[model samples]
Target: MQTPATPKFTTREFRDVLGNFATGIAVVTSRDTEGRPVGCTINSFASVSLDPPLVSFCIDRQAGTFAAFQSHGHFALHFLAEHQEEVSRRFAKAGEDKFGAVEPVAGIGNVPLLSDCLAHLECSVYQRIDAGDHVLILGRVEAFSSRKDLPPLLYFRGRYARVASE
Candidate 1:
């Protein structure tokens, strides 16, 4: 199939288009070279493959903790619940102590896992794909658990939103 010509659009326009779709928020955690904790909030988490039990999340190559995530073979994906907006905001900030106050416990492969999240996914890096300005990290899921009772935190159209239960 022939590819369509690139459309004329600005970065904001592109972001606006993508932002129309709602996605769950997650905090991806890993350790630095010295075993120091590192992480950031991301909305790009998704299931990649079921047969191999793989999941993927995209991280900006220019993010401060991208190097730490790239260096480590394992990391944890914590799905933020509706009540954990503070956790999302905390991790999203640059130059701030994302884990300064909260102490996380080690999960599979010594990766840090946050508490009270809707779910936790412990994974080892399965593959790394460079996609434009972001790095797609495909992880081989070693273990995962979720709280079925909580509503997940979501992002849509440049702001936070929720699913209203009927």
Candidate 2:
């Protein structure tokens, strides 16, 4: 008789394994009280529903941008293109001026959208659920726009990659 395979993995191991699934990179931006831009690179973004237009992403509790996102009540998610890896790295880094070196335009109530993203979504905070080590943020999509010519920036296997056109 053939035996079925058994799986054995830790949380970190599972995360690393799941990282093989390529995802589009995004910069989730919000304005601080002083109206300064705060952004973070998030690969966890996903579309939730179409009827009500909902989207979701997870923010690490320890991330520097967490407070800004929490207090702002609104945010802009800019899905980066394959060429925007530098932009993604800039936002992902700590203690760096993410917007200082990049030109961003104000969209949908002063939310800053990176100039050349594949798509931009302006959203309002809908709800938050506390998960271990991360907070899942649900946003009500207020407005959105996209560019047909752009291809999404992809992340997989701990690196940034691009999709090749057929």
Candidate 3:
């Protein structure tokens, strides 16, 4: 079968449409050559396969952490809780020192893992694909953890949102 052409949605429209879907917030963390922390806020995290335990997330082409993540070969994903919204926003900024206030310890190959996150996944770079203005990073999970008592931070309608009670 022939594939259909790409849809002609404007950038803003595409963003708005995607924002309608609620997603959990996460921080993708790595370390530099000097072992300094490097990370960025990302909401594009998702699991891909279960048998081999694979996951993926997207990073903007211009993000400062891009180089580190691309070369470091390992990283960690921290699923944020509702109380960690500030941590999310701090890392979202392009060049800010987001980790100055938070103390994160090393995990799997010294990837920085923040404390008190809803969940943590330590992964090694499995694949990297360049797509338009972003790069899709596929990671093979080697270690993981979760805190069942915390509520997750969510993103919807282009802003951070709280999970509602049942």
Local distance difference test, each candidate: 0.94, 0.89, 0.93
Clashes within 3 Å, all models in order:
0, 0, 0
Tens-digit lDDT string for candidate 1 (1-166) = 9998887998899999999999999999999999989999999999989999999999999999989988999999999999999999999999898898898988998988999999999999999999999999999999999999999999999999887987
Runs off by more than 4 Å, candidate 3: 1-7
lDDT string, candidate 2, 72-131, tens digits: 888999899988999999989998888886878887768888888899999999999998
Higher TM-score: candidate 2 or 3?
A: 3
Q: What are the C-alpha RMSDs, in order, of all predicted structures?
A: 2.1, 4.9, 2.1
Which stretches in model 1 have alpha-carbon errors above 4 Å?
1-7
lDDT of 1 at 36: 88
TM-score of 2: 0.90
Ten-residue region with minimum lDDT total, candidate 3: 61-70
Q: What lDDT is reached at residue 63 by model 2? A: 96
